[model samples]
Target: MTAHLSRRSLLGLVGAGAGAYLLSGCSGDDESSDPNAPQTINWWHIQNTEPMLPVWAAMAQEYRTAHSNVTIEIQPLENEAFKTKLTTATQAGSPPDLFQSWGGGVLRQQVDAGLVKDLTDDVQPWIGSLLPAALQPYTIDGRIYGIPFDVGMVGFWYNKDLFAKAGVTETPTTWAGVLDTVRKIKAAGIVPIALAGKDKWPAHNYWAYLAMRIGGLSALQQAAETKNFDTPDFVAAGERLKELVDLQPFQRGFLGAEYGSPDGQAATMGNGGAAMELMGQWAPSVQASSSTSKKGIGDKLGFFPFPVVDGGKGAGSEAFGGGNGFAIGKDAPASTVDFLASLLTVDNQRKAAQTGAVLPTVREAASGISDPNNKIVAENLASATGFQLYLDQAYPPAVGQQVNDSVAELIAGTKSPAQIVKDITTVAKSQ
Candidate 1:
């Protein structure tokens, strides 16, 4: 339960609506003012694979061509490696000129240490071009700190063919309905869900979504603020998840399953070995990559928002997820901000969206999405009633890791729901 913001409140933060904004401010006119200014922008990002890796490189080359005096040095690292390297760099007080950022608790820590620049004034002129919800993660204390390139939410990525076989004629819109669907799918000899239990973060999503649905969007935030997750709503969230676990809907050896392995959650779902998975915008691409055919069950794939719980304080429209963005280091060249702006242009964003690898943050770039699933996700995010960043990202890293550990224990049948909540509460208090 990250801090929640209503759509109207988010819109107000941008001053103007997204449709009215333009990318005029992002052009390198300031660099042009001083033609011979030699500035090398050091950019570190995590899109180290195709088609995004090459796409990003091309964008950097294009930028360099436009501003002859500026050289953009791109360091594309793998996810874990990037985190490790960035942590080392930041700790040594030499953060990259511009690097990948997810925003929320981590970004907050960076801000506290004065490792990142405040982009509020620099980006305000064109910030509105991005969907308001997309900016929620990058914003701290109502101040903008990063520029988002992609945004999305978590939801059910299901197999329509499997549902049909299970006689589930309609998508479930309530928690009870979801259970019924799962039971039916199990009865039909299909694995109801694909879970990467070995990867604790994946299991954490279920408990987090349950909390959001039961305790409302602000529940996690309230718990974090008070360092108390032992409330009735949090307990109920665990109990409800327990009900799902008791059904044994996941695949064989699910507790040890990885996410992208050949026999993991994505592969299981991609190969049609499991009926559904709860994941973010990147699900389809990963599924395809992990499948035996190296091509997922394409048309059979479908998506739906997580179901609502009876008598819950939360609505069906509150979204839970995060996105990719770039944060500027404290001493980055002035032109670094401009270069970031250039990367988020409608044209560049549209190119990224075309790869089906990202949900473009720029409103105008959304039209470039040709995939129906991506379109559905984008539309759902656009109309989301409330926005919450992923719990692992929204809270301190220690607390977040505790959440993943506690939830994994609950799923493994070793810890009671009440006990898990108490464990999480203890970690939050320590944080």
Candidate 2:
């Protein structure tokens, strides 16, 4: 699910639990502080929903049953609220023992401030079990600071029936091919694409993915590092997107459309009103729920990776995405690492995958993925050579929102290719 930063918000029941202390603290060396001292781990995560929330509670209950000398306190918060509360807590130097982290500039700042634990050595033995792409964001300067539970990517979700109707016999493999397919679909009396202009985030993907395909991963990293996005590669990315926009491919009133509403982007694709949407791993489920029939396109739905640019430096296997992860706080008890180990075990990862809420970070748990579409994504993600975290999550909030807004304007014909990049550059430099 995308917005690793924005997939969900659901309430969960509270559970009280005791704990047993046996694991040693992984890092830091204050002589007087004992590694195995009895302690209560204050845990926080954003899986504030039925299957995950309860799964977490049961795991804590298991720890409580292990011994009488420890305690396990859990706090499950909705996504936005968790971010808000975490900001306040970290500002005060009291982050929970373990908590949700999307890992980027935010987590890097935490590490710089001594608020996060260094898990480089602690997770070494088991960390190799996770997909390297999933761990990319959590590894800072060659050291691990966080652990991923789930990972996913964005791709084009298309209706196979519509593609057949439009005579697109094969999925497009290049940007030019994508344009030709759109033309074919449109000429066949079908709306070629469904976009959520009102939401902005969905539109942001177009420009971002185009930038990736045209300029390669280093282009994005350089833009962030240099506080500039007005490079020729970025400009060409926007120009490429403008080509698509000029095709008049979107549904009427697309500028005002939402993403998951009954008459929005997902519904347009789900109901076969439009051919496809460039979205995240969560698209299919949301499409089903938003459709009038509540069954969506069903077996007619198929996904393809974003097409490559004809003369681009980027590899087709490079992807744009993000996922949910957990970071340890500097002062967390010794046993906290053990507790986390329990949560990420192969058995536990499989259980999480079974619930259909996550794509487990561990490879062995893949068989538990019941959703066929999710299985496809998980398969593709494993072979990905490089991954760019969702732009909104990778950049600071203001810069991220500016990319979303500027790109939306680009699609609306209110901003030019050069203008959007410059606009984003201004915000990035200011930040």
* 34-77: candidate 1 lDDT, tens digit per residue: 43576767788766544466677677777777877676667666
- Superposed Cα deviation of residue 99, candidate 2 (Å): 2.9
Candidate lDDT scores, in order, read 0.82, 0.80
Error of 2 at 162 (Å): 2.1
RMSD, every candidate, angstroms: 8.7, 6.5
Please provide, for model 2 over 161-214, each residue's C-alpha lDDT reduced to its tens digit, 9 standing for 90 to 100.
Answer: 999998999999999999999999999999999997887888989899999999
TM-score of 1: 0.87
